[model samples]
Target chain A: MNIANKANRLTPYVFMAPAAIILAVALLYPIGYMIYASFLDWSPSQRIGEADFVGLRNYVNLMHDAAFRESFWVTVKFAAVVVTLEMFIGVGLALLLDRNIKGMSFLRTIFILPMMIAPIVVGLMWRYMYHPTVGIFNRTLKDWGFEGIPWLSDSTWAFVAVVMADVWQWTPFIFILSLAAMQSLPRSALEAAEIDGASDMQKVIHIKLPLMLPVLIVTLMLRLIDAFKVLEVIMVLTNGGPGLSTEIVAMRIFRTAQEFQELGEAAAMSNTLLMVLMALTIGMFAYNKMQEGRAAKMQAMAAKGTA
Target chain B: MPKIVLEGLVKRYGSFEVLHGIDLEMEEDEFTVFVGPSGCGKSTTLRMIAGLESVTEGEIYIDGKPVSQLEPKARDLAMVFQDYALYPHMNVAKNMSFALRLQRMPKAEIDAKISAVAETLGLTDFLHRKPGELSGGQRQRVAMGRALTRDSSTFLFDEPLSNLDAKLRGQMRAELALMSQRVKKNMIYVTHDQIEAMTLADRIVVMNGGYIQQQGSPEELFKNPANKFVAGFLGMPPMNFLDGEITEKSGEIFVQGQGFSVKLSHQKAEAARAHSGRSVTLGVRPSDLVYDPAAAEDQSLLVSIIVSEYIGAQTVLLCDCGGQKVEVELKSTIPIDRNGQLRFAINPEGVHLFDKKTEIAL
Candidate 1:
């Protein structure tokens, strides 16, 4: 190639080199290591190079393991329930608070305070609050002449307790994003909707929610992905106890590798979780691309019409 | 046949009042336009009427019924916004039929209304397209169509054509004028464009500094402006003001200033004689100045042409009259050269005098 042609070809890559290098170090390397380690029967006591090549043994064992399967189902159920609840409550709160009242800024700050705390701290706090004998909730119920219910001891109550903790800590993530989306919506459109004779409920259902769908979809996907990998708070509070009711996949993988010392099996479980998250991420990207394409098509049509 | 009345309407933000005690009445089926520069509270007044902005201190009556506390939906009005404000997620047909559907009208009636408006707006071919797919002009038409489909007692337009390009804005303005004539509803439009105000309004309410300067028919506001601001704001090239003193020259009244002096007409002189020796502003439209070489000295201005802009049939000459810059519009066929000194006679009837301090027309 001529020097000019070579320089032109090199220009794009020159500008892209930093991102490429960072992607290799930050993404490709860890995934590559995990894949290689998943094929070996490794242990915490042995060097990865010294480990035996076990081929499909770990995968075959994972398929038969009842505990792993239970934990996988538990993770899916937890993610589904928590994300659904959080989306409803969060978007509802955003709608109710999306106004210009005094102290709104202060209220918004307070609403998001739970999301900013450390997950471990959140777990500890909620654990104390869920105490059946002496917690504020039970005390209040007792004062109201109600029975003190077992919050964390019974299997069903333990699941509910963990789900409540997760919801409390993460609903704010959806709230802030939904609020920002609501605030940035075209003000003129809302005003036009008002003048078009749409009632308040109709505006919320037909205009606000549909207009906020794109942002809400992305937010839901992000929260669902994060929910699948949740472990810290569940670990600190229930520790996957009360008959495996709160044993999410991340906790399962941690216990598999650390408690059982089965690094290969844990790697297999991690790979499965990674694949689920990858599918979700790909779905989100595809949705965003479709939205952008639709927008561009509309603009082109509008231009042609005007022209 | 709703006659809208705004009585003692005021808007305030905390302690700062933006619209103070505005009282106005619109007869049934009148096209009223609110026009002013930015921050003149024209939009605020329109929003209050639409019930989008709360009336801080007073009441609005429609057909003699108090409706200040009513919601916008209950007020029986439709608005076309500046940005077109089409629902981005809905197709044009659905957008136009939203209000009808909300009212739970029959499906057949809703379909008929949608198709009728769509056909009128020439949007039938693009009925299935979402707003994001339409051009600015098409979106503007859809906004109009949406309002038309509602068939409300009143229609409000808040600078609906301001978002379109210059050519598109002109085209849409013509279309809006035609639509307004066809519909004959009680319409209140707001715009900062003087041309829009002049061409579209049955009555133009010119506002400034959060106050209504003048309100009258377009011709009345153009020919007999109550203030210098209205005079300058209503014309195409704008009226020019020359700082001059009202002087009594040989028992006749003349406005003499830096570059030229012109004898006031009998009526103008009578008005100016009351303020003799007081500094005043001489207002003259560009169209009022005609090129004349043999005109009398006090009736004509000797100006040196600095720049001549030829716009097809009419040419605008920027001339220096003494130290003041004055513009004169003449036939493009007139032979004029740069740096040439020329005399242009002022029409006696076109002369306007204003108090220099208050800018009120005399």
Candidate 2:
């Protein structure tokens, strides 16, 4: 009987073993390899076994590297700007569309179409759109008797163009998630708010936004993490042109390993990017844990009442 | 408090008409309850008055002002939803003071009002807890406290206690009665529970299929329901409906059905006399049938007990009268033979006759 009970308790772990093995092999292995590689003075020409061990040398060098510092700041700015614009535009669109109107479902489908496109395709599409004389944007401007703006040739314009393309592609993700959250909100509370003399704006502020905060926070963290590592769209559009203005950290890391062939520095840069994203992921999880902990405490009290 | 009137209020979703046309005048400071079964439009009517659902083809007048096109905020009211729609993120005090805060009231006044309502609702202890942290009963009280703090001229309740357990529902029903008395504001409560409607309503409006079947004082409606639906909808164990035909034995009128014949009371006989020899339904409450072994055949039904439900003090017996089903509510002390047949006399005053086709009281 004792053996059987032990076997019963082990059933769930036995079933979970396959997934655990796959996760270790597919995910943790690379991450461990990357962390080890970040500490070595390695190059593309030499095998990892032949590389010399360097303790925090790559990290120490990155601290003084002017190009690395510039790219880091650019990555932060791009993530901050794009995430902020996407959040506002996405949540605003969700609020506007969360209503009953003719052809609304079709409209919502159209809104999310940008997010469904491949990142490479989105980059190529926007690059053509941002072409100085031949692109749609400048062509339209010239047609209206205005000077054609050099979208990708100027530093500020290149950054702006990349930011625009990033916003266009990812804003739909935030919009769809926020719309689901907004649609699932307790409808009767809104009705009660209406009866409580709340205007439309007041209801959104006092009730809807507060209820949707959890989903919005999680969505924001996910967007920020994705925004920091964005490469294809910006690479296709600007390719770090106009003096590293649009060179995000991911692009820098790619060029460092490919063109410069400094594998150790690239790994260090990737690890640094991973650490930043890890902090955000941890913050998101901490928020979720706090919410769940409160809910569980309340639920335990409710169970006590019933018992 | 303002007098509320709904004139030809109609609600239609596409071509499907849910509420046909309802005309009602609710007096000031009245606790009027709209009671009906599910899909009977009692909630839809109340939601229309609350301005949640738009009036399709008519006008709602509050204090002689047309309000069909007005926003819900323009209607001076407070509503407690069936789900107790307290802001999940807000504490009890904040939930209660949400509307007052929106009005930009002074902090001290808002605090005072919230404390007063919390004290009355017994929510003072849980004032700092969010709705999620409170138990169901506490959340219900907080919802009530929120409405009370509003001090709106009209208070709307949409099956507010139907979500609670039976014992909690009884407690909340009593509290609601006390609150209505203390506030003396116009209260419109909607529920499918007949007991809640009977106990809490000063005036009960029984609705069915989008029409007001009957509306009057609780006692008046209980004594005389306008039709078959209202009669069955507003009573416990429901009024037993037996198909029969009205007939005259010399000058006295009687209602004859499959297993029994019952003499009509003098008042009902006159009405039955007009519709003599016509098919009708004999409606009797479960309370109207009394255990009596020595009653005359014309005044009693001979029925064999089928199932005996023992519900402390009272034993409800489902019986078969000939081939038709009839339910009887009896005292537990009453000696009943479960396998054998018995006789139960019908109270003359409790007999209700209705037209077979129209189901309208004759």
Candidate 3:
């Protein structure tokens, strides 16, 4: 009996061993290493054991670095703009497409096609189309008897091009989520709204949007986190060119590690980005927990009332 | 209040007709109930009257104005859906006041209307809480309160009480009866439960196979159902049907079957003689069959009781009369010889005859 009890108690841990090992090696270890390296004056040419303990010097240096500040602002700007535009356009498209038109399923499948393409391919396609003199956009402008605008060479236009590419590739993520949320809503409520004398616009504002808020908020947070870490697409497009106009923190961290050979500063930047993302993830979870708690409380109240 | 009319209302889905030209007129302040089984199109007809469904080949008129092409908002009516259809995000007060606010009514008036309806529904304390916080009965009341606050010419109910527990359903049904009396609006209700139809309706319209089988007061329908379906659909333990052949002996008409023969009453015998139909069915309600040992054998059923179901004040005995099955309802106090055959006298006034082929009352 003692042996059986001991084995039964060990069963759960035995089942959990593989996942715990993989998590420690693949996830926790790298995060722990990055946190430790952020406190060091490490060089890529030297081994990690030979690096001197710097004690917050890299974070302090980042605060004073003008380029880092500019890149930080640029990242914040890009995230705010892209997420805002994506949210509006994505939710708007979902509302407009949530109808029983012929071939609607086919149309929805076509609308999300851009999200399915590889990000690197999207960057290449946009770069080709944004060529100075030979691109389709300039060619179209020239054909229309207008002067061709420099799309990629100017700092402001570079930022705009990057935003456009990000929006095109990612708007569908929010769109699909919002559409699913809208489709799963209590249909009778919408019909009731119709009978309640709400106009089409009123229905969207009062009924559809309010009910879809939780899903939209989570989608917004995910998109924001992903927006801050955009690296590959921007690298292929502008490579943080035109006086750091489109240089997000992730791009700056990359250039610091590869070109500047400052491993500690790169690790510090990675930690900062991770902290911001962690804050957003925590905020998302808190909101979900609050919603779940509200529902549970309501259920308890209902049960008490019945009792 | 407005007089609502459905003229030749037809509904079709991809060439499959669900309602085959339903014609009904609901009087002002009348409580009309449409009752039927699933897929019987009672709800479809109600939805059409609410303007949520487009009429395929007919017109719905409210107060002599054709409103089929109008929006639901323009129809001057409110409906309580089966699921309550309360907005999950809105509190009870907001839900009840939604339509009034949309109409741009004064805030003070909306508040007054909401408070009044809430008081009537006993939802005063829960006004600030969302629909999720309320119990099932409370949500149902809120749905009712929402409709009540509308002050529309007609109120539509689509099985609003079907979701509640049996006890709560009974309570809400009583409340609805009182509310309908006080409100005095033209109310159209749809339900598959016969008790709801029988209890609350001023006029009950029994439908089957997407067609109106019969429409009348509850008593009229119970006493004289126009057809076999209406007769069987309305009563509890559902009016028993026994196949028989009408015959004459010594100038007295009798309906004879395999295990029993019943002499027809004068009024029913005259109709039976005029029916000119070969096969007929004798209808006897459980309440019509009274246990009497001294009753005439020719006018009573000789049935061997098989199963006795005790339900409080009454016990229903399922019996086998020859090869056919019959049921009887008696006081639970009555002693039973479950294995032996017994006689239950058939009430003459309750003797209903129908042409078996057409299932039409003779």
Question: How large is the C-alpha RMSD of every model relative to the true structure?
Answer: 2.1, 2.1, 1.1
- What lDDT tens digits, residue by residue, belong to model 2 across residues A172-274? 9999999999999999999888888898899899999999999999999999999998999988989988898999999999999999988998999999999
lDDT-sorted candidate list, best first: 3, 2, 1
Give per-residue CA lDDT, model 1, range B251-277, as digits (tens): 999999997989988888887899999
DockQ of 3: 0.80
lDDT of 3 at B285: 96
| lDDT (Cα atoms) of all candidates against the true structure | 0.91, 0.92, 0.93
* Model 1 alpha-carbon miss at residue B9, Å: 2.8
Q: Considering every candidate listed, which one attains the maximal TM-score?
A: 3
Top candidate by lDDT: 3
Off by over 4 Å in 3: B275-277
- CAPRI quality of model 2: medium
Record all residue pairs in model 2 with backbone atoms less than 3 Å apart, i.e. clashing: none
Stretches of candidate 2 exceeding 4 Å from the true structure? A1-18, A302-307
- DockQ of candidate 1, scored on C-alphas against the true complex (2 decimals): 0.79
| Candidate maximizing DockQ | 3
Candidate 1 clashing pairs, residues 3+ apart or interchain: A298-B133, A302-B134, A302-B135
